[model samples]
Target: MSFIQTLNDAWSRTQSLLCVGLDPEPAKFPAALNGRPDAIFEFCKTIVDATAPYASSFKPQIAYFAAHRAEDQLEALIAHIHEKHAGIPVILDAKRGDIGSTAEQYAKEAFERYKADAVTVNPYMGFDSIEPYLAHEGKGVIVLCRTSNAGGSDLQFLSTSDGKPLYQVVAQLAAQKWNDNGQLGLVVGATFPKEIETVRGIVGDMPLLIPGIGAQGGDVEATVRAGRTANGAGMLINSSRAIIYAGKGDDYAQAAAEAAKKTRDTINQYR
Candidate 1:
């Protein structure tokens, strides 16, 4: 199935707008899964088994896995998740972009090696850099338009020569200029409610991967109001530490499920 079809299935089957971030910080794992050789993968599998039914998708930031030369372990974790949850779409949240060839290699690593349904890309390197990622059939290419970090304003909020913010330009380019395969999306941080609405305008009906909903102090109601498409869904609200680390002991899975359900219910309030 194609990327859009997989995501559509996930959203419909799970009845959720929640995208759980399986970023298992080493220190946050349960003591039983912390010091083991494959603790990262074990922690990830436990989360997937517990919350896959509640979450629409799972995203694992590459940096978290790249730490300590754990790429092999991360790949194993991805395979295990795909094996167990055959229908659950996984988004590899590696914000990568560079020259054409290098971008192609990155695409191969994320798509062929890890079998990710979608990979986030940084568009600052121009469309040529993004084109290589598009070559992967049925794979989503999410561009970073506006981020939630405090330093994001240093470039994102600045007005371009045409009097539009840089993020607006990125959204227009990605949505209007490059969205053809039904696999393109924008990463619009929920921290900026007004900016999220503005991005919705530029992106018409495109999917949005929204972070910062939990633990980052983003307003749930405002983000839903601003982020959802006309169909009342299209935004992926991600919560990493808040959900995965909800409990540190043996009841971690239950706590994580509760956290996921709570986030889903809260988002539904505004949906």
Candidate 2:
């Protein structure tokens, strides 16, 4: 099955838009996992198992592993998700943006090496920077548009000759031009619900990966009302620190599960 098909199945099977984000920060790991060489994988695998019932997707940010030289653990965690939580799409949140062979290698890293179902990419360098990822048939290529940070306005809000913000232009291009293979999706932050609504209008039913809900304080009601498809599904709402770090004790996995369940239930209430 294709990435989108698998994602659709996940939404139906789990009745969720929640995309659990695995951004492991060792400094914040629980006491039980401290000093373990495989702490990153162990912590994340435990959380994945505990919360798999409520999540429609899992996004593991690559930088979290690379910074600690834990790429092997990252690979193991993704493999474990595939093995134990079938149908739940794992998105490698690498946000890679390069051109030519470099971009191809990045694509290889995300699709072949990491074995992620989907991967996020930056659109700053235009179509050529994104084309290589599209070469990997059926793999999801999510483009960054209208990011959640306040500093994003420095560039995203700047008006182009079309009198629309740069972000909107990116949305138009991604929807009409870049999505020929139907493998494209957009990352529109949950913090910007109005922009999310606007992007949804431009992209129609294209799936959106929305971050900023939990630790970022994005309003769930506003995010759902703005981003959901007409049928009330078209989002992979992500929450990282808020869900994964819900507890710091031995029962951290259980705490993460409860947090994920509450978040999934709250999102459903609005949907």
Candidate 3:
């Protein structure tokens, strides 16, 4: 199956668009796992075991593992998620993009080396930066359209002399013109619901990777109302620290599951 099909299939099974972000910040880990690499793996294992049932898929932010020089350890974490959740997709949230040859190597590392089912890439480098990822059959290449940050407006909303904002231009390309292969997805901020609707209009039925639901203080209710299609599908609302660090103690995994359930149930209400 292709990446879109795989993610949609998972959505069907879970009845959810919730993508739990397993960003294991060392500072937020349980006291037991504070400085231990093995503890980080164990914590991820516990959280995956606890929250997999409620999640449509899992997104492990690459930076968290990279910060600790624990890239190899991430394989173990992904393996654990697969073992426990079976077909649930794993999206490596690296937000990578580069020019030409460098892009190919990055795609190779993301898909072959890491074996992630999906990855987030930046579109600023143009289609050449994303073309390398299209070779991975059934893998997702999500382009960063509008990110979730206060400073995001710095470039994303800049108006061209042509009158369209920069991100709208990105949406037009990522949705209609640039998707030579069907493996494309777009990243839009949940914090910006009106922008979500605007981009949704541009993308049609393409799956959207929505960040900033929990930790970044995005309004979940508003995002769901705007980002959902007629059937309220095709959107993955991601929550990381809000879910993972809910308790920050021994019951952290359980807290994470509860947080995921709250998010899922809340979105289901609008669905």
Q: Would you estimate the TM-scores of all the predictions?
A: 0.97, 0.99, 0.97
Q: Which candidate tops TM-score?
A: 2
Off by over 4 Å in 2: none
Per-residue CA lDDT of model 2 for 1-271, tens digit only, reads 7777887888999999999999999889988888999999999999999999989999999999999999999999999999998889999999999986799999999999999999999999999999999899879999999999999899999999979999999999999999988899999998899999999999998999999999998999999999999889999999999999999998898899999999999999999
Query: Between candidates 1 and 2, which one is better according to lDDT?
Result: 2
Model 1: per-residue Cα lDDT over 33-152, one tens digit each? 757988888887888788877898899988988886788888888888788888788899999989999999999998999989899999889899999889898999999999988898
Question: lDDT for each of the candidates?
Answer: 0.88, 0.94, 0.88
| Residue lDDT tens for model 3, 75-177 | 8888777777888999999999898799889888888888889899999889888888987788899999899898889999999788999999999998888
Higher-TM-score candidate among 2 and 3?
2
lDDT of 1 at 38: 81
Write down the TM-score for model 1.
Answer: 0.97
Per-candidate clash tally: 0, 0, 0
